[model samples]
Target: MDQRNALLGEQFGICPICLKPDPEHVDHDHETGKVRGVLCFSCNAALGQFRDRPDVMRRAAAYVEGNVWKPKLVAPGVYRLPS
Candidate 1:
């Protein structure tokens, strides 16, 4: 079988990130150009928007889950989120 078809079959036609079916786009690491997996269009676009930064993605996920950071005033015009 073709490698792409094999991969799609391995994923059961679902986007690994969003668990949506019929993921037609191939996702890869921009830095190394290595194939990561298949992803739906929206998820693939979202990764691009996030610049493939895992930290930023985690924060975004946290924000979406209502874990918004409450910045503490440290100094004049300086606010910091608790670590």
Candidate 2:
């Protein structure tokens, strides 16, 4: 089996982050090309959006938990920005 398939088998074909089944993405270290594990599209996308930076992710988590401000949806396509 391919490395991705093998890792998926080890992870029970589920996303290690969200624990969703049929995880088709192979999460890896872009710099080192190391195999991390399998992840679903959403989780992988989130990581990519964060530039695979643990510091950024941690700061985001802290921001959410800190609750500095909460933005509200004002309309169907509009929302208020945090101050």
Candidate 3:
């Protein structure tokens, strides 16, 4: 057992995704008491990219779901300049 693992509860320390005996790297949202998930180092870093901003993250999700994103552009991309 990892030294940090002792911090989080025993059985609770297991990561649900990989079901690995993850160390004490439990991540939670600062704004919300939302239990994100138990993750290993890689997944934890990935989650950090979201920064716990559900609204912003949701918008990104909507963009993906609504087909607002484009893939494989050969030429330089053009973006709207903010006014």
Candidate 4:
């Protein structure tokens, strides 16, 4: 039928990001204004708070996974993280 119905069917009515059911929000690319997938309220809000930055999201995921990077003092009051 419609786009929303199609998306829900495609995702099986679950939030793809969190794998939770009854997702109510349609997630989209802000810059491109393209529909990505259906997401639950929390997942949608999290993406909004992250400002849709994939790099930042990746770092956040890493931090959550306990792969934290400690900053090193390179100079006076200057901290740098190893790349």
What tens digits encode model 3's per-residue C-alpha lDDT throughout 24-68?
466667678675554677657656787866666666777878845
- So what's the TM-score on candidate 3? 0.38
TM-score of every candidate relative to the true structure = 0.88, 0.71, 0.38, 0.88
Report the number of the highest-TM-score candidate: 4
Question: Which is better, 3 or 4, measured by lDDT?
Answer: 4
Instruction: Please identify model 3 stretches exceeding 4 Å from their true place.
Output: 1-13, 33-37, 53-68, 71-83
lDDT at residue 67 of model 3 (Cα atoms):
42
Error of model 2, residue 55, in angstroms: 0.8
- Candidate 1 structure quality by residue, lDDT tens digits, 8-76: 999998999889999988889999999888889999999999999998999999999999988898899
Lowest lDDT block of 10, candidate 3: 1-10
- Clashing residue pairs in candidate 1 are none
Q: Rank the candidates by lDDT, best first.
A: 4, 1, 2, 3
**Could you list the CA RMSD of all candidates, in the order they appear?**
1.6, 7.8, 7.7, 1.5
In candidate 2, where is summed lDDT lowest over 10 consecutive residues?
A: 62-71
- Local distance difference test, each candidate: 0.90, 0.85, 0.60, 0.92
**Worst 10-residue lDDT window, candidate 1:** 1-10
